[model samples]
Target: MPEENYDFMMPNVNFFGPGVVKKVGERAKMLNMKKVLIVTDTFLRDLDNGPVKQAESSLLKADIAYVIFSGVEPNPKIRNVKEGKKAYIDNHCDSIITIGGGSAHDCGKGIGIVLSNGDDLPALAGIETLENPLPPLMAINTTAGTASEITRHTVITNEKTHLKFVVVSWRNVPLVSFNDPLLMLDIPTALTAATGMDALTHCVESYVSVNRNPITDAQAIQGIKLISKYLRRAVANGHDVEARTNMAYASILAGMAFNNADLGYVHAMAHQLGGQYDAPHGVCCAVLMPTVEKWNIISNPERFSDIAELLGENIAGLSVMEAADKSVEAMIRISEDVGIPTNIKSLGALPEDFDKMAENALKDGNAFSNPRIGNKEDIINLYQQAYKA
Candidate 1:
């Protein structure tokens, strides 16, 4: 291989496996995380023996005092970030611990970034706009995940403007992140399916992205293989520790890939759906993955063919274009079998809104890394295709 150069990013430390939730407190204490603000959604905080309790118990054991801020919402809103920041200040917290899935992590990042940088999310909406570093954060992820646990970017929706913003900066990346399969053992099948597909999207999108390098490609390919082999098992039986563990590994790898290479049109489009409809982020990605990838296949047919093999296709003597088609078919089949809706129309979205969303999607940071750049009209057409699927 020739020498290839690209930036690689990761959390300071990652703890993986069963019972590692306890490490949150241990690591927090080691980092001198006193009076931590635990950011999460109400549902996870109320769930019995869920991620919140697991995190709380660890903090208690480590004698780390904490305050709970359970106001984060699905497709997390701008107000969620503002309220979370207020909670952090009012409680006089020194660090942050976010539990649950991507929403929780993103909310925490937004809060921490604003607390140190400024109150305006729109100001810091682009890459590396934050002036100050965030308070130390430790993310204890629950779902198979959107990979927010490790990524440096935060997605926050400005409810007033109906715009979703991605805040990308190293300042807000979790100082530490880890995945404990035990935390996911009780996850509902639908959530497991959605999050699993979310991870798969990350791998495939990054693998074919313009910013991708040899390093990210290796991680993306491994992530794709793991998701293909384990997502169904994890969705079928959350109690199956092996399946959960492998999917967790896949999430970790996917996070690393997209964190560096970044995402493509799938995330760009999904963010629009999430901001506009408050749809489940992973489900939005799941429903759009096949449609977007099919449209993008021409940009890198060889890579799509490779994704087909990772998705369990027997591509033995198939041409590149044939294998690429097989890959899109595999994505559609997996998404359908996992119970994700086949079309965006089913999400109660309006075609009338597509024009505005397409404009925003074109400006999304993820769209910049897509192999084939799309215009507002192209994005609108893509939405029409997804809606008609």
Candidate 2:
């Protein structure tokens, strides 16, 4: 038989710390970026002292010209990508810089994907579909979740169908990624909780992914540890520099893990809720993770046991199955401690929609990597479990 194989992917370059945002201008100039397009949301652009202004300061110092596209919504939409493409073309932008969280990064990727290929965004959905290289892109992240800045994946929503689709391609990875903890200090407590838990979900799902390898295992384990220790602190006090910094590391590490090993049912199921309700992606992940894992534990009890230990659960005396169950318990405990809503019902999900959500979830790119195999009925029951959980 042929040997098993996998590939690892991340940004070409990365900068992490408290003041790394200051490097954007010089980096763009180094890349020969003339007339750059800065993609963000209106909120970030309007903030008096937000990351966008800081990036502008650096770009101005480097004498790089740029136009702002701040039309990105919570779950980036097809129209947002279309409008961003128009902005890029109209401004004659030779490069792209995205500021803010995953929405901004994904939107930036979507814009570049269509510009380099064609205008049909929906037609380009799925893995390794892009044939052309995106323009030089830099992502300056403002949130500690989603990790879109470094990954080869981007999620775009089709507003007409109310469905989210994944676009995965090595070419879509950003040229550079900046993670400055200082920018995350102003994030609200609820957002902090949701995004941090999102990082945790990435660690867990990637650790148990069917495609996991030694490299991904190491990163995922460390990500779980960092998130377990610092997420609560970051939520309790946004100004905790140490928490912010470690959480940044946690997010990047988890991104690195999942970017290669890929994800599982948590992301698959979460994507549906996000598209259906236009809810927060991280929040949806946080709510559904434990339920999904509860079903997935049987696929690899040792991996779940490792996650339990990483989360600081006391499983010394328990059997492997019992210890594996602690992983789900630990997830729930941390989720509740960080203020995630108890169930999807609170996020506006209805029973009538579960069937369709389940159908779309099974078709999601992440579903293939899920450790456990289940049918439509199993997926629907998982949704029901999360709804009442």
TM-score of each: 0.97, 0.98
lDDT per residue as tens, model 1, 221-317: 9999999899888888889999999999999999999999989889998998988888888999988888889989998899899999989999999
* Candidate with the greatest lDDT versus the true structure: 2
Please, what are the lDDT tens digits per residue for candidate 2 over residues 126-212? 899999999999999999988999999999999998899999999989999999999999999998998998899999998988888
Clashes (N, CA, C under 3 Å) per candidate: 0, 0
Model 1 TM-score on a 0 to 1 scale: 0.97
Q: Which stretches of candidate 1 lie over 4 Å from their true place?
A: 1-3
* Count of backbone collisions within predicted model 2: 0
lDDT of 1 at 129: 85
- How big is the positional error of residue 174 in model 1, measured in Å on the Cα after superposition? 0.7
